[model samples]
Each structure stands twice: as C-alpha cells, then as structure tokens.
Target: MALLTVKNLKKNYDGSPVIRGIDFSINKGTCVALLGPNGAGKTTTLRMLSGLIRSNGGSISFEGLDYQTDIRYHIGYLPQHPVFHSWMSGKEFLVYVARLANLDKKTAASRADELLARVGIADAKNKRIGKYSGGMKQRLGIAQAMIHQPKLLMLDEPVSALDPIGRREVLTLMEELKQETTLLFSTHILNDAEEVSDELLMMHNGEIVESGPMEKVREKHRVDKINVVLQEGFIPDEDLITALPSVIRTEVARGVHHIFVTDTKQARDELLQLIQAERWPLERFEVGRASLEDLFMKVVDS
Candidate 1:
C-alpha cells in the first residue's frame, strides 16, 4: 500500500508555475530517488512533500492522515546544506534535537547515544560539531532527523558537497538506514541513486518525467548495444562494423568503440563473425543494455 499519496500537486512563484500539476505515490518501506538536473524543481517537490512549504494546489495524503493536521512529526527532512550549532558536541546536538521532538531528558540522551552509534559516529560523540568533518556532520544531521523515528526520511542532495571519502561514508550509512525506514532522497547523481534506491521518481521542468520501480525504468529504456576495446596499436574496423545491417550508429573514444544496434542477437552474431574472420586484436567485447544514467539523460532531454 502507498504510505504517501500526492495528487495534482502544484507550486508557483509570482504566478508562474514551477511544479505543474504533478502526481506520484510512495509505497511503504521502499527507498525512492527524486532525480533531476539543476532547476528541474526537485527541491521544490521535496519541500512540499516534507511539509516545509505549502503547495499552491493539490493534495498530500499520508497514511490516512488529514491534510489539515500537522504531519511533520511523521516525517524527517535533511536539507542539502544542513546547519548545526558549531559549539555543541555531537552528543549534545542530538539530545537537543530529540528533546525538541518531545522526548523526555532521559529518553533523549538514550536516543542520542543509540543514534550516534548507529550512524557510526559514537567515537566522535563528545567532539564539538564545529570540529566534525563534512562526512561526520552529515551523519550527525541524519541522526538528528531520525531522532523522533519518523516513518519517512527525506534528504536533499545528501552527498553532493562531500569529498570522495565523505561521500562514500554517507552513502554507506544510507544503505544501512534504508533497511530501518522508508527513504525518499533527491539527487542528480545517477549512480548514487542507482546504488541504494528501489524506485525512482524523475523530475524535469517541474513535472515528473518518469516514475516506477528502478528495474522497470531501466527495462523500458533499455538499448541494444555492444562495447569493444581494441588492443594497443590496432586500428578499429569502424567502417566494417558500421556496414552491418543491424548497426545504427557508433561512438569511438580512444581505443574503445560503442556500437549501437537495432537487433541485439543479429548484431552480436554479425559483429563476432567479422571479428573472427579478420582475426582482430580484441581486448574486450561485451554486449550491454542502457544504464540508469543513460535512461535519465534520455528522459530529461526529451
């Protein structure tokens, strides 16, 4: 069953619509990715879902909850750039947020300690927030968001600003956290979303371009193709490969060639036959389908 339902959602600024009557739903206990390029209204959509802002039109129904009631208690939101009390230690910060969420002092402290360890930051619990690295602070932000144990968690561009090490740290944490509660995160990074998301809600120019299970989306947009890497000093038989009946187009980079085809079986047979006939020095030859990145670009561009 859908845990959250949004219908005909609309948002505008100065009489110009940014989210143009979009609709989608999130099922229980699934990790959904809100994907789009810059200015695609990803942030605006997330804001409306988390109740951070009011939509100009449409309905947001969560778990039989009334629209007129407060729903923030059932949801957690972490903005792309989360702010913190620089002077407070990680432990102090979590407890403070937990108390604000209506936990008693003892419960707050206990929750803080539990979350600090869950997020892999127990060793830095007493360290000041100001001294925390980017990754540590992001993890702390996540712990604070979950202090009340909301049903759904929302993160906006969670790892966009972190270094490689920091990015890996948060991504690893996200992988683990998804098992505990429903997660809906917005990101432009295709690989990041692909790594952890079970479903995808793709946005572009204020509308949902695609929405479905990750595998379904990839399957619907799958392309037939083969990638070949030529050995050093061997010139690729590009002209010969393009002559095949199933070949549609070809892309070459350095010694690697990507041959786009209309029929995978036919193309694979003919290409292999040519390679064997010519005794070409092949380093690698693999048949593949469109990836999430390839599908994302296609949807956004169209």
Candidate 2:
C-alpha cells in the first residue's frame, strides 16, 4: 500500500501553471526522488506536498489520512535553505524543534541526541549552527527532520551545497535511512538521484512527465550506450553505425566515439565485429547499463 498518494496535482503561480496535474505515489520504506532541470516544478511539488503551500487542485493522502489535516505529523520536510537559529547549538536547536512538536523535555533530549548520532554529527552536537560547514548543516537538517521518526522524509537539494565527499556522505546516510523510512526529495542533479533513489519522478515543463521504479523505468525506456577509446585516433563513419538495425546512432568527441544502441547485446557484438573487420587498433571499449540520466534526458527533451 502507498504511504502517500498524489493525484492530478496542479498548481499555479502568478497566473502561470507551474505543476500541471501530475500523479504518483510513495511506497512505504522506499526512496522516490523528484528529478528535473531548473524551473521544472520539482520545488513547487515539494512545497505543496509538505503543506507549505496549498495546491490548486489535487488529493494528497498519507498513512490512511488526508494530508491537509491528519498526516502532517507523519511527514518531515527539509527545505533547500534551512534557517537554523544561529545562536543555538545544534543539539539545542533540535531540542527546540522537538519541543515544538510536543515532545516532552526528557524525550526531546533523547531524540535530539539519538538523531545527532544517527546523522554522524555527534561531535558537533554542542557547536552552534553558525560554526557548522555546509555538509554538517545538511546532516543536522536531516537529523532534525528524522528526530521524531517521521515515516516520510522530504529533502530538497539536500546535497547541493556539499562537496563531492560530502555528497557521498549524504547519499550514504539517505541509503541507511531508507532501511526503515520512506524518502522523497527534490534535486536537479541526476547522479544524486541515480545513486540513492529506488523510484524517480521525472518532472518537465512544470509537470511530472514520468515516474516508476528507477530500474524498471530504465528498462522500459532502454537505450544502450557504448564508449570507445581507439588506439591513437580512429573515427567510425556515422552511416555505418546508423545502418546497424535499430541503433540510435553514434557520436564522437576527443577521439572517443559513443554509440547509442537500441539493443544492448546486439550493439556489443556488432561493435566488436565491426572493430575486428576494420582491423582498427582498439585501446579500450565499454558497454554501459541504461541510466536514470538517460531516461531523464529522454523524458525532458521529448
């Protein structure tokens, strides 16, 4: 059963439609990522889902309750720009939030400490928010969001401010959290969504154009990719590649040509055979699995 359902959700800003009747659901104990380019309604959907903004039209139900009323308690939202109290220590800020959520003082302290440890910010528990780095702040944001153990977590651009190492840390943390909690976050970065998401909601032109389990979606919209680095420099004729049955085509850059094959196995064999026939010096070749980025590009571009 779905923990959250969004059906025919629509919204507008300044008389311009921003989210155009998108539909999807979030299952229990899964990560559903909202992916898109800028101005693709991802942020708008996130805001509406979290109750920060009312949708012009839609039904949002969570945990057997209407989202407008009974389900807020079960959802945690971390906005892109989280404004923590600068003067308050990380622990103190979390306790403050817990208190506002009606946690008793004793329970609040325990929750704060537990979450701080869970997000790996225990060492900085006493440090003020002003002193924390971008990654540290993101982790703290996640800690506070999960402190109450909400079943649904919504994080917007959670790793946008982090360096590569920090981004990996956040993704790892999200993966760990997925063992028990359902997460739906919005991000423009394809790799971030690809790394940690089980399902993807691909938004385009201010609407959710595609959505499904990530791997299933890729398979359904499969396009094979091949990258080759020829010894020295070799350029395969475009017509030769296009002549291959159902193969999309070929592209070359910096002495490396990439083939987009419609059939994965056929592309592999055909390319190898062609290489052998041409007696071309081969340096390196790679056949890649279908990727979320490919699916995403296909959807948004179409």
Candidate with maximal lDDT: 1
What is the per-residue lDDT of model 1 for residues 104-160, given as tens digits with 9 covering 90 to 100? 999999999999999899999999999998888889999998999999999999999
The weakest ten consecutive residues by lDDT in model 2 span: 63-72
Worst 10 residues of 1 by lDDT: 64-73
Candidate 1 residue pairs that clash: none
259 Cα displacement, candidate 2 (Å): 4.3
Instruction: State TM-scores per candidate.
Output: 0.91, 0.87
Cα deviation of 110, candidate 2, in Å: 1.0
lDDT of 2 at 207: 78
State the lDDT of candidate 2 residue by residue for 205-289, as single tens digits: 8777888998888777765688878877465566776787857878888887778877778888988888788877889888765
Candidate 1 regions exceeding 4 Å error are 236-243, 249-251
* Candidate 2, residue 68: how far the Cα is off, in Å: 8.3
